[model samples]
Target: MKAARIYLSVLCLSLGFLFGFSPAEKKSKATWIWQSEIIGQDKQQVLEFCEQNEINLIYLRIDMNKPSDYYRSFIREATAQGIEVHAVAGHPAWAFTSNQKRMMNIVGWVKKYNLESEPNERIRGIQLDIEPYLLPQWETERDRVIREWQANVEAFTEAVRDETGLMSSVALAFWLDDIPTPDNPDMPLSKWMIDQFDTICIMAYRDRLNGSNGILSLIEQEMQEADELGRRVLVAVNLKKDMNDHASFAEEGVVEMNRQLALLPEHLEQHPSYGGIAIHDYRNWKEAAADMPPVDRDHYKGTYIWRAETIRTEKDEILAFAKENDVNLLYVRIDMQQPLSMYQDFVREAKAAGIEVHAMGGHPIWALTESRGKILKLVNWVKAYNQEVSSGEQFHGVHLDIEPYVMPVWREKKEAVLRQWMGNIEAFVEATKHETNLEVSVDLAAWLDKTPTPGQPDKPFAHWMMEQMDHTTLMAFRDQAEGIIGLVENQMKYAQSIDKKLVVAVETKESHEGDFITFYEEGRGEMNRQLQLVTKALEGYSSFMGQAIHAYEYWKNGKE
Candidate 1:
């Protein structure tokens, strides 16, 4: 057992929480389908559509012939933003193949893909759509056809459990509940699906829910059975236009469809298995829903994750607080020995909450002398961990907190140490990009703008760092709002031109350096007031990503 050694407690369900909040869970809010047609097209549009709609899951049609890297890249990027991708594929015949060979092949393929993938480049789960209803004599010979279909599902599920190590989901029609199995005559076919698979997606398909056979009534039994089984049901609506208009939202337009979809939670969320709703395909959804709202801010408004408390905390509580406070990013250190399962859970929760977890740890010495080897090891660790965990559970990026100026080498030769620091950061970024596709960020002292480079005496060191790195945090560790603003004001002014994202961070951790160095004594309430002031002051710069608290321990301690 690998023990995760850390000064702080670290557990997250997604985005890999930095500080030590212990637990978090997500109720699937939104989901969508991708029918593989958008594979080569403008994929960015689909991602944007999901982001805007707050879609938490995607059922992507698995084109088996497609290269592993192709799926890896898309799934990796999708998961980083909190959208999970499950490989969905099935022809009615696939379920009937000799020995369930087709299902075995898919499992083998995903296994190989996982073996080869960089961390974050793996699929979340397996969702299959083996629609036996499409067979030639479905209307004439329904009973036998349903039983055969049920047998196929059993075989496929067995293979998934024995070989793939992935959660299983089966696409189902709302009326599947009408058919019951021989062994369990009382159990509905829909209930059997829920009982057998990790998740069941009821293709409700209808745009309305008022009367009998409408969306709600169709899935009522599935939801009830799922709740009893301690499983989940994903309600799927249609965007496919050629299908029945009552089933597809296409004819209703975006606004009316959204109104109906919103009522799902109103009626069904009371059930334990009410995971969320999923639309048929992204392309159709995007084309038809032109009036959906746009995402507001896409920058860093984060906090320092710390774990300096005697009492434990709930991650759900912390996440709730984060949402209310507009904290979307978290910076924390990584303990290499951490259990892979723990990080996987953290990343999932964080992504669902739309919070970024940047792995935050670096000593000045790690950058100062002969540190390239150390840097490589660190990058490798992130790569290993990211690869080891489930898709969204991987770290969002690296937040290197290497303050070289605080070292003795900086005192002896300030510019040389700064140059070494910049070189180390550059190398880390290069290696991280090569090893893992996660975003790279570093912490900088605010005064770097005033401190000129060693050889180029006229050019500020901050400019060089800015050119080398795009996402950065300025350690404007002042207690007062004015002091914080004054320190990072120049960076705020110049960051736009350099095309960099700068997070202005203040200290809340208790510091022996100076009383004015931190707001730990002032408390979280006071820190919030000062941070609000800083936000107001820097409202002028669109490049001002936002502010960050030093660490969770001090922040939480202040609350106490």
Candidate 2:
């Protein structure tokens, strides 16, 4: 019966080869590694190693903190090299928590990512690492725990399939051979798990194939069962030193590990289920020794500023974050005081790194008749700072964040304040162009169009601000993308007529400003997704430049 089973398994695998495996993957070796720590990787070096070693797949952790485009860039490059990439993550409780909302969260995120990503960048599969046996409740409630875990596994896999429409896989321990199921105590654990997931990554964790605990010994039966069931089998090795010494090739190092890995397929050549070798994680295996620069784009991606003090204090961090988010236009504050050099230094580096540094600072009073000179001083100071620095090492433009409604003058006489603010802005705009050819941009509340003009309340403030400045950053401030787009729709049409570029600004800062104004409650991922909606709505409009996130400090710390 065993011989017959092996023969039938071989036949099934042969058919799988005929119908399932991609020709490129079949011709190339199916080496893979898990990138548990993908943050600091030199993308080129990692891809080079994979190409040289014939690594066909990488199990990358979804960097939920970064934007979706972040993963898309790397995945696109990997797929171009004929390497497959899958989103991988696990937490045992994720599968069984009330509502299993966390599992749904993962599924939702991956689904959105796929929808936003290109064909090559879309995930090939989702490798779930829900190690239920590792949970504390498993030991005390063995039978019940096993049953719940089995159910969770099946449920989670189903969700991935039905929701994401992507192939699903799971990491399993090699010892899970014959643990009985609650439904049928005689059922093998391997059989049940293999049935639940499309591919089983066996955590073999042994260095050699001779002893009872050897890598081959552990998976010999697994491969046979895999062949019989038409399930794909992949053996994994631990690269970390803290694991059982004999369980990994940590002491032996990468050279020896690669040498041994080369011989794996040969030993299991006859096993129909043998797919490939997957190193446990990139972080550990990479030390066995050997290796993303960001991709540049052609867009005026920008951010708004409510905190120049924070930028000056945390310049390095702010600069790094700017590059991570691919920000080009930087709206920061400038003063002739103590931190003057900080401004110049920031502008210098920004120019060197192909980023624009625009000086930004304004008060509501600066838009009144008495304070017209004050706003000009800010602009003149920016012009002088530009002259002080090298030709390119200066403020790219000047941005005003003066919102007259915030002043008591507006309540006292709304139209009177509007007329005065318009007059002050007219003088400031003319002076800026006359003094320095710098492009002037102002930040305005998105509801400016809805706000009634003083005596002529029928005509919105948007009518009076025609060609008032080169660009306008509308503070749409809504957390959700749809609401934000709605806020800017009328302004977008007006801007196209007036020939002023409009930047739809969203609030990512956690502020008590308003309930729906800021995405402070939402993480960077959601914020990024929301921005995509803004871009899509206003795409192809010369007047619609791009979006501006509320501020850096709030966006950086909002996740906490």
lDDT (C-alpha, whole model) for all candidates: 0.72, 0.72
Off by over 4 Å in 1: 1-170, 173-179, 182-298, 306-314
Task: Assess every candidate by TM-score.
Answer: 0.59, 0.46
lDDT of 1 by residue, 1-560 (tens): 12242311122122233322333345454455555757456578778877766677887877778888778778887888887777777777654445367666776777678778875888767787888778775677767666676777887677677654678898888887887765687877788778889988889988787789589888888888899999888888887785567878788776566656655654874797877677777777777776554324445678876441211235556666677777788875666555544455455565656677777677778767587667656665666566544444568787677777777777888767776776787788786786346788888888889988778888888777777675778999888998998898888778888777788888877789997899977878888889889988987787788777776556655753
Candidate 2 lDDT by residue in tens digits, 442-494? 88888888876666777788656646777888888888888998888877787
Q: Which ten residues in a row have the lowest lDDT in candidate 2?
A: 19-28
* TM-score quality measure for candidate 1: 0.59
Query: Runs in model 2 with CA error above 4 Å?
Result: 1-298, 305-312, 452-459
Error of 2 at 409 (Å): 2.7
